[model samples]
Target: MEKQTSANKPHIMTIPYPYQGHMNPMLQFSKRLASKGVQITILATNDVKTSKLAHTSSINIEYISYEIEQGDEIPKSVAAGLGYVNHKVLKRVPGIIEKHKASGSPIKVIVYDSLIHGALELAHKLGLRGASLFTQTCAVCSVYYHVQRGSLALPLEGHTVSLPSIPVLEIEDLPSLVQAHDRLYPGLLEVIKKQFVDLEKAEWIFFNVFDKLEEEIAKWLSSQWPIKTIGPSIPSMFLDKRLPDDRDYGLNLFKPDAEACIKWLSAKATGSVVYVSFGSVANLAQNHMDELAWGLLNSNINFLWVVRETEQNKLPGNFKAEASEKGLVVSWCPQLEVLAHKAVGSFMTHCGWNSTLEALSLGMPMLVMPQWADQTTNAKYVVDVWQTGVWVKARDKEIFTREDITNRIKDVMDGAKGEELRVNAIKWKEQAVEAMSEGGSSDKNIDEFISKVISTTT
Candidate 1:
């Protein structure tokens, strides 16, 4: 066998969009590639603080500086961030590559977030391979692809949508961006549309999903592109346990109230607590917050809800005191740990892809309350297709009410339907493990990716 040296190992640089959700899966994928003996470098804007995660892994994270005066305005900041990445950062990648090459570890490939439009072109310009890492599911990506290709016209004509390999979707079930293009931030809408620009030119396209989860859509999309499903992208401890001490993702934007949550949950009986969160980004309107708070109270079930400090003021007056006996409210909790705990009966979530995958991986059913973006689509699959959970249905002419939330929580906890949801959830959890196990679908795809990089680079 040839001796492996720093110079001979294939180096790959990962550039994720500067968001917690985007950066996490890319970092997990880096860990997977590193386990296979490939050299991994994760590039981020200087504003992102990933040192805690970086110190825990063998992978290297390099931060590049680009000045942007961000403020309370989100859309403005997004526009500025995109500008910094496309123009300022793209211009500097070559120097970074040369610096790495001089250090005896040259970047042979650039694996970038799919939403970044210029990464593939820049990779080809520098004579390196490019792989687009899509953090969304095949179903959501297919919808976006059709929209970009002009097959699904904007200002959609009807109340229903039918697409290849996707279930017939109601107009409201579509992604919020697609449903109301004019209402959302224009900058983000444009960035999402650019996900398919020159997409076919990439050397590889990877989705953070398992094949069986979206079998028909994966089959159709794979035929057109060099697509691979190499995910659930969760830590090893929760899935296949192939990697050592991989219990957490190691990067959390918010510190978790771990001890309090675990101790409280430990006191409860198995399958007795409701876990509620809206993820990191989604900020519910005051009305929605009030509804959710009272709804959990009305469910008459033991619950733990993560309400960010910013959103706590929106809660009804004396809410925490009233529900103190039955509920625990915290800013954040270690999500995977909470999900894996026996006390957690079901998740009341916004159905973000990462959260959905985490719930599925842990055999926890969901009461999906989709807020925006691809969440609506994920909620649909969770309820209609996967049979893993029930949706939080709203009353007529109302978005969602306290009564609706109370009913959904009951359906997932004490109702007969909860049994069916648990059965399906356990089955999906086992399938998730199989996908990451040795010789499994995602594992095989990852091995193939590593081999191709080595063969081409060597």
Candidate 2:
């Protein structure tokens, strides 16, 4: 083991892409590094309100805020908003780095989210090492790399492509970013394409996944660049052994309605409640919301659904009155806590990687309904590879009916099929736990990453 000194200790600056999903994983990784004696500075965008500072008992971790000017009119889609933020962040990077360097804690390395490609150029200007932290699954990264290599084509609509390590996927299974009809399609596609360009310039790349889950893809990616698998980037409370007091990522953009949801779950029967959430970015049309509400009501089962505060008005009229007896709706809830509850038997999700991992780690079966981006790919893995969940198809590639939702929920919660899924979910949960344990693959990978950082600085 190496002893640390103020001058030689690895001081890392980590910047996520200014979104909830991206920020959570980056923050978790920073905490894990801080626990190992590294000093970490987390950079957050001013557009979103976040805690100015977060300190562990050791006080090695700190948060710094930077501002990105916003226009009066908001962007209508997630991809557009991401593009806006990414551009703003790039413009401010050089100044942000200079200011930090003048303050005496010069950054030795920068670990940036893959979406912010401009960081690589900034790193070059400052003569600092740069690494990319991809918050999505390894499979998506492999796919994107091939697309950059000219092996796969964009606007791959109505075509089936097979990759070396991943399952064969239809164009429909690809991210919605490539669709011409998507409002943000062109901007999002360009961003992803440029990401691979900047990826080649990074000193190393890190994936928020484990080797066992994407063994083939992980091996393939290593041939291209220095890569490490250091994830299932969950809270320490859920998987790793940590100080009793080190509990949250403390980076949530939305305040959780944890107490109310927990009380409702306490009154329900074990394995009887359905947990529904679409993650932080996706938005549902009013018709789709109506269908979802009616479907949950029609099933006559207890459900806890999370609708964003902005979208609450989109719910069907009298929905609260009609479903109050059986369903509980909240703007947001403490998801991991809710899923870990014994009362949660199944999940209805948008198949975001974070949400997917949380449900699998808790041994809960899922009804996967992916909306856009890497979520479609995640849905494919949930249904075909893991066999721990069922996929719900939308009619005419638009909206799925209320009946479709009802039947999917009933099939997973009532039939022999449901029992098999439950067994598989429990098996994956055990595997995840084993991976995060002391000698497991994820644990070793993190240790290796820390050692590499220390050696480089020394």
Candidate 3:
């Protein structure tokens, strides 16, 4: 496990926003690049010293630390309100760049998360090649590129957009925030226009979603920009090491009670339990949670819910009394393993690309409730393109009672329509296996992209 250092090795450095969502993908990319003989340096904000992700020490790459904190006056454009990609993440880059440039090992290229504007600029200022890392689907990334070209940008109001392929689906069939933040659509536009002082300086765009999975969007991305498709990077890296599928602290931040969840699942018959998780970011109001709880109850289905503490909207506590016995609730379970468990019939999800891809890979059908931008799109694909799931719209803040929530859950979980989703879900699962195996589309795309990376000259 010695550092592979030589003049000929490609000296590639990476910086990911300290959140698990950003860090996980960067680690996967670093691992893959290390496996391919690159001399890698992965820079973490000084906060990583306290974060659990810093525990993984790889000899192939050097860990350079940058400190991120509240004191550094950060711009509001990048503020996510919480987590690593906040203002603190951006303020650390100037120091990180200065340290890397002064160090004897000159950085040849930097791959950084798109949310971090300062680091990418500093890398360009140092005459280094820089790439933006996007963990979402390529369609979303292409939309960013389009927005940059002024193809889409309206006054920030309550306007809805009709994407090219989406059908005339109701809001209930889309995955989006109940409050409708239009987060990715608007926030990313601001990042391009205001946050990154140097937009044209980027060398490449790296996506963690593969090409075949996003055929039309990937094609559009490649036509306009130097784009690389290399994902469900998590699964590729998970199976990259000749190891069995399991959970690690790298992805699951909360202490996983996988055994507990799986044991409960084991007690149920096949396709009897519904696995519910709304992803890392999204949070529901207490009234919404009560309705959802009632819905699961009315459906009379065995359900496992990953309840986040943020859903305490003054009503969750009261609703809990009704749902106490009918559901198994844990803060977090090993998501991948739980989804693959024999009894997991369907998933209730936020439709984040990572979660959507994982559910798709596991052959689990979905009941999509999206909280942000691409999730809405992902939800549409789940129900429309794939024909393997149902999507729920965010209900009005006051009128959405428990009875309504219970009925929707019953529709997707216990009714005749739910059966159709299951049949198609199993079919998509077969395609996912084909895509992951040797000569599979995912494998082939990675090979093609890696070949381009190897053949390209600085």
Candidate 4:
């Protein structure tokens, strides 16, 4: 496709931390803006630019690539990688902005992922408006805001904490990065601390959530910043709420084993299969993997599991052969499609925001096993706020036993409690759909955001 050039139109640049979860929502947001005739330039790493899995068809959205130094040697930890990328991107912004200006579509504003705080400062230096696009929920953002304000203390693992206008949460339910003792904590904490500082400086803060979904929290947050809710940022195919031709989000980092997984799901009874995935980033310990395999096999449930190719060898020996009778394991499966299937009754997930929104949108109850970052908070919301799923708590704050996993899965997929969770899941699904539909909260917010961009740029 040819690049469209229109100097009069508002030109917005988006920079998402280079990951599937961060890229997906930011891409969707760009698509929504492009649909409204805005010129969008999405800055991505060289890896995403070359990967065949990353796809999008918005005519107004252009992708600019930058080389990540130490590309192959970048650490696997999200916190470490985030810091590295933020540093690289901060240096590249001036050059990128100059290239766009040379093309006569000078960037009028920047929409940056919350993790990359340096971008906001750069935007100010360039005389461009900067908006913080939080890919996580408002509750997590609020917690971070409080942390920056010194209203909340971190490393409260053994204590319960309460925040104004939010639910009471144990310190354990907070983002794991706040644990001062973890190896990545110091760097991650510094990133977050800087983020809060930049967030206060940003002109607007956008969340990938709708007002109705988290009304109280959103309202409370809006009181503090110029905030907008323009999301559920899911594929139009799944939600059927966006423009008619808009379908997939088109941001897949992994090739999906779609046909095989769908065929397996087709053979299962409705609400009978337990779908498990820990998302793209989180890694499981070897002992935890063994316990998970045993737990799933011993539970006597039909399951579809997505284990990454790199981690497949960690599974117990002969495990696939024995579990093949009732389970299907693939390197990756089309998650949105799988969750929307009638066969998928409950999900055993890492509670990433994207995964959580997908499950809620499809009315699929969850068995949340959050790993790190915003996941623990998402799990807390799932079990306590929404009542649509059960959380798997680590035994003695260190290990999660196979029995605990089995019991939690059963609790959400079998009895009276399971039925209630299912009903609640369906309720959330309906609410999500309504929020995305025409004239709904998310739709209105997007329209308003586009209007603001156009007005400010003009």
What TM-score would every model get versus the actual structure?
0.95, 0.91, 0.79, 0.91
Q: Which is the better candidate, 1 or 4, if ranked by lDDT?
A: 1
Q: Any runs in candidate 4 off by more than 4 Å, and if so which?
A: 1-8, 50-80, 155-158, 181-184, 393-397
- Global local distance difference test of model 3: 0.63
Quick one: RMSD of model 3?
4.8
State model 1's lDDT.
Answer: 0.87
The 10-residue segment with the lowest total lDDT in model 1: 68-77
Error of 2 at 307 (Å): 1.3
Q: Runs in model 3 with CA error above 4 Å?
A: 1-9, 45-71, 74-106, 156-189, 192-201, 236-251, 312-324, 393-401, 430-458
How high is the lDDT of residue 151 in model 1? 91
**lDDT ranking from best to worst?**
1, 4, 2, 3
- Which residue runs of candidate 1 sit more than 4 Å off their true CA positions? 1-7, 45-51, 65-81, 395-397
> 268-295, model 4: which lDDT tens digit per residue?
9998999999999889999999999999
Best by lDDT: 1
Which residue pairs does candidate 2 place in steric collision? Answer: none
TM-score of 2: 0.91
Clashing pairs for predicted structure model 1, backbone only: none
Clashes per candidate (backbone, < 3 Å): 0, 0, 7, 0
Q: lDDT scores for all predictions?
A: 0.87, 0.79, 0.63, 0.81
Clashing pairs in 4: none
Clashes of 3: 7
Task: Return the top candidate by TM-score.
Answer: 1
